[model samples]
Target: MPGKTKRSGDLATALAALAGLSYLPPVAAAPLTFASPPAEIAKAVLDDEPGTVAVGIWRNQQGRFALQRNPVGSVGEVVEDDSAHAQPLFEIGSISKVFTGLLLAQAVERGDLSLDDTLGKLLEAKATLKPETAAITLRQLVTHSACLPREPQDFPGYGTPNPFSRHDRWKIYAGLSGMTLEHAPPCGAAYSNLGMGLVGQLLSDHYAKPWDVLVRENITGPLGMRDTMQYLGRQASRLATGYQHEALQGPWDFDALSGAGALRSTAPDLLLLARALMAGRAGPLGPAAERALTPLGYFRGDEIGYAILIRGPAGHRTYHHDGLTGGYRTLLAFAPDTQEAVAILASNSHASPVKVLTGITASRYPIAPATQMAPAPAALAEYGGVYQADKDTSFTFVAQDGKLYRRSTGTGFRALSPGGPDTFVDADAGARYVFSREAGEIVRVDYYLGDSGFGGFSSFSGVAGLRTKEAAPPVAVVSLDTQLDYAGHYRARRIIRTDLDLDVRAENGQLGVRAGNWFRRPVFPVAGKPDRFAYENGRSQLQFERDAAGHVAGVVLYENGVIRLRRLP
Candidate 1:
């Protein structure tokens, strides 16, 4: 269904965040300075993208700087806001979850709720609950480990602009009553909108009030976030028009799931929120800020401090969260130690303003899309091999017609544009990939999804997704008969089922372990370690023991301790 669209770069922008992205290496990781007027940085964010963009940066003594890049009359240009002041409303989608989480923390501070309280305890009067549902605690819900699914059961029109238009309070409670969890509580930090939505609902139910109203009274009201609310009302005109794939989109509404992603605000107002978060418990945010930001669980491989994703290390810890809805994108990140923060709001749904913000916050210059050029086929051909990662995943690249393409899990044949000699970027944006070589031979590829998690999806920025050539799957297979001395079954009773049974089949020094088991994988020969093989692409290695007769007898794996598996007939 294609039509003459008014939106900018609809197809390219739509794929920006969800597509295959790689990471770039700046000169070094440091604070970005603003030599050119902040406007230049804002333009950098808007460069190579569509629509209006605005950001607010704050420092301890520096106060706050607001910059806006207004769309150039729906044309192919972007202009700085001549208004001199940033005041435009945009939907802060999942970011609303942090506010919901804040409410829970506030309730905890006020003795209105306990983190350990179960779902059944709060919603028993409103809805029936299964055993697992009843066991869900407030902590699990806020941390996104409640084991709840992404959406409520029997959700109507789940993928439309108005995903929760029909999901009112009644339906939410009804869905909760019979809800089932795939696993027990604290399910290892998988993002769950339904779980956070339930937190808002359960909190509102306890107080017998609306969830958004609670947000106003407890958070926005106290913090003077006047422009932040679910409904724009009088400020409706100020609300920027949101878009998806170059077509205009209507406002998104949430009845019971308002806590999940149902709030709109301006860059200044969000900057206020980030500032409050930086102040910690002693500040206007009260103990709730500290409570919400306390390390709780894992989120996208890092730490999830309640609703916020906590990154960096001690003294440099940063709290951040991003929101994306119908046609708007929002992000808020602040570091208490550096007393610095960044807030971004964009009207274009296709492009990611957050990645730009990521660059701005990381360096003094604006991070732009790498200008890609056609690379020589000889250069591309060297990258046409398989790379294995630690988490049972692999990346296979193919060079065809002077272009390099990737064959990965979900995405099929995404082209990688040359950003540098050994670096490539996704044409759709939101990703960058870098290649490394040792001794003039390509060794590993390091990449990131996008600068932001929009995550709990494919791309989360910051963390490196490393793939080593040494961990690559078998390329030149040799017949099993060639390694007859090592070709046999091995069993480990000490380890988990993962390595309980091993069928070592190899050729050309590559050993395929767990032949008949589910996680069957090839182990490459480890350098300087004779009779030893590696798996997880070299993250782990094991030694093959031979009996006195020189016949392969067993395999010994070294982890935290030795795990010996006897050779089986």
Candidate 2:
């Protein structure tokens, strides 16, 4: 809310009317030249990020170029209103988990699959996946460390609006052979989009083909790519169509989570798959997909790590990955000792391609900023203990004034903001945190939630509803006959007792609910003190527990997982 400052005579009468139209200086367009980009830092890194509209930036390994678009942002029905000859086409979510990690490193270099093969020898008849996830392998499902079960349990019956209907991939692997287990395998590095959509359903059930025609016959027609594939309405004619600072869409077709957030392409076919996975040289991943991009671990702590299909900065270690559905946002990177690589892709789902590829890899490769040292006061009390990432989660931080704040880690002390000098910044802005010092001492930190998914309740944690700023719960007014009997619909049932339904309604005087389309709404009661509630999408709160004949009997549901529903009948 801090924007009202202009009163030095209204900023000297708006700088004397912009100093008389600044002698007509509006010409722009020629300053960017890293092979042509500066169309205003490419429209502030893709239409100033409010549900962007086309932005492609690839560098090196031959696919060198910068693509642009923004006229009014929309990718499908062409509302890039001539943002300089728009040519959208995106989706590329999960950067299609690097073509399902190069189709499982080309079936482990054609010895036909065996990254320690298991999943109890790849099933598909009386089907099964959980027997402690059949001793997970296939290199722990392309390095997500195969702890399996990131999804399935009929993911809310997959919000079916043709959610890639092939009878919804046999009800999403018959609901992933009935779910269980949330941690184990390599346990630490959790990013799984159902572990790369089960390595694109185990490379389309071992190439009996149909994971988008085996990734268009083993990786987009042998990297000729031509507007890539994995249907967006059969490549909605050079697709793109997607945006979200409220609406305007097109291009979202995940057909069986198309091996983890489907692919569509065009950043010149992801710079020919990031110059053949940063040139370990020659395509479908050799040198074992460059040893499956070496990086697993750090699932949390500072927030980023998983190796295969790379991420942020790598080989000084950063390797990255990012993608989102419902409007596309993609990012891919490589740094294996700086042969350097990057990919951005954006149509817009809050386009923040990891701060546009970490400010374009620090403005086209600059690095060299790590020289701060000297601040260790007795290893700041072993960086103030308590780290705990899973075991009902934990987080603490507190080395006060000598830096390191994060206190109330169970959702309160967000503090950690810096980005180097031992990195920081989480509560998901695609999470981050890296420390590991030693001779100067902090030892180990690592938590990088980037390459998405650890997701749930995020306005990127600005500690929604100001959590412990104390005193807020006390608003609930109700009574106009309990707001007209809590406004209507009401169906209830599914809070995991399963058969689905749920609904619950009550408009104008608010209330809402939904369940499958995952809705929520209600928040009202702004000034008085009655029973407390919130959720106009984020800052999700809701009190209403009653039972001394006060009527309501159910609802505790605090933000990410506290649920409690009841009140049936």
Candidate 3:
């Protein structure tokens, strides 16, 4: 951590000392001479970070905004004079989920909608829905417990820009017909983009206006958030250039899914939102904002209220959310108890502005480049444990060689780089972990990451979330002939999308399933379920559907629910 008075050499020494007695090599041949950072996280220090970073700070009812654009490893004493310029717009990504959630709350407050209102009642005139789908409530969609899949599988692919653009009112209405209630409604509070998008659709229809129009009429217009909008139109020039790694990326647009992550805005504009949220009953959307911030249930490692994640105890809680699209990244956080808020918008996809946010609030900035020497072996052991999230989410962290490693099913531990004291960074997952200590002993570890859903920073006190056994051994494979028996073209019977079909074949006698338009993916048989196969590392499953004659008639694909496909004759 660099204080306004701390020298560069002191920072290196401090970084080295974080790993106990281990020595660390210098990150650069010669320390870059730079002017002293501000005593507070003013514009000077914010400029020190790489890429384009726009930040908004609200404290004691005053709002301050700052923006900085510097290449990696280029920041030194001389700060770029960009502070006087206008704050550019940014694609705020999943932070839009929060706004969508707030929209639902606003409707609830106005008596136009009820959290308990069934999907059937809301869409009875607009679209036909399966019995199970119709029973889903407005609250489940807002809280991401609607049992909807994470996203629509009928897209070009995850790599394509504007992946959700294909989704519209028709598909949303039609998709409900395929719903199969394998699990009860409000299924375990997992993150679901589809669920929130549906909320946006229902709200839009209920108001007899487009989704964006509804948002403006109910929330943004009342709060005077002019720049926060669904469409850029003539404001395109004000939108900053977004980047993913070294390549410049294009902006994203959506149709019906716009409610999930379609809005774009400035840091200053976002701070206005935080202000309204912190004001609670005193704000314009007081009742809705208050209800939006209510802690309803657990998601990941913390309590969730609408689309925001709440941490800390009682009145001191901090409500936060992260938004990530291909080219932009964003974080919006506010504390009602202290009336403090921070909104960060980064132009580069790779920038971690949470460092800036946490740095300003906690006064603890992370070590840059982020690699560090291993702590003593004895010190590393304290971090080993298992952790769980959202009921179905879980992982294990193993301490080794001064680095803690983690994996979904608890084996195959990939190394995590240390960021700061008791903090670990998982770059792949885009998350940061911090451990807490009591009486010189590790007590709890907390972390948060961006996703399609609103799981807040998860805290595992001691090993409570992670105290678990090892993963089970690999399941035995069935005979090769048995695998070959299932090889054939399986066309979706009722699902209306190109991404609906699957081709199963035996390559070198091992069964592989090519789903939709993508290349073939290998399948693993589930343990104790001989007829079923799992793929995409078990995020999806396939169970061959058969008739009374014992002939394979089709296949049922299981993601969040079952979608049936018929075998081509």
Clashes of 1: 11
lDDT of each residue in 1-569, candidate 1, tens digit only: 01123222222222222211212211112223322234544555444334567766665445444445445334343344423254778888888988998888888889988989997788777778998888899988888778886567665432354766678888888887877777878775556677888888888888988998999998899989988999777889888887653447678888888888889987777778887887887889977888888887665434677687775444556677777776777778777876777777877664455554345334421224566676778877777776654232356666765767654432224456776668776534335566778788776675543323222122332334344543323232333454566788778764355546666754223345543212234554455566776654355677989889988899887755777889988
Flag the better candidate by TM-score, 1 or 2: 1
TM-score of each: 0.62, 0.27, 0.62
Tens-digit per-residue lDDT, 1-569, candidate 2: 00122212221211211111111111122222123342333454454333434443343433343455554534222121212233557776666776777677667767887778776677647357777777777677666667764445444322222233342556766665776676557664445566667768777877777788887876677767767777656557666566543345455566555787667776556656666666664545556556456554333322232234333333344355666555566666655454555556767554544444444333333333334543464544455554444432334454544555442221223334455555554322234445565587554554443421222111221111111222222232344466544333323355466533334454323344544323233344334435555553336665556688777656555667656665566
Q: Which model is ahead, 2 or 3, in terms of TM-score? A: 3
Model 3 agreement with the true structure over 315-423: per-residue lDDT tens digits: 5567777776656777787777678787778766545444443332232112243656667767877767655533443555666445566544311234567766776
Which sequence of candidate numbers ranks them by TM-score, best first? 1, 3, 2
Worst 10 residues of 3 by lDDT: 19-28
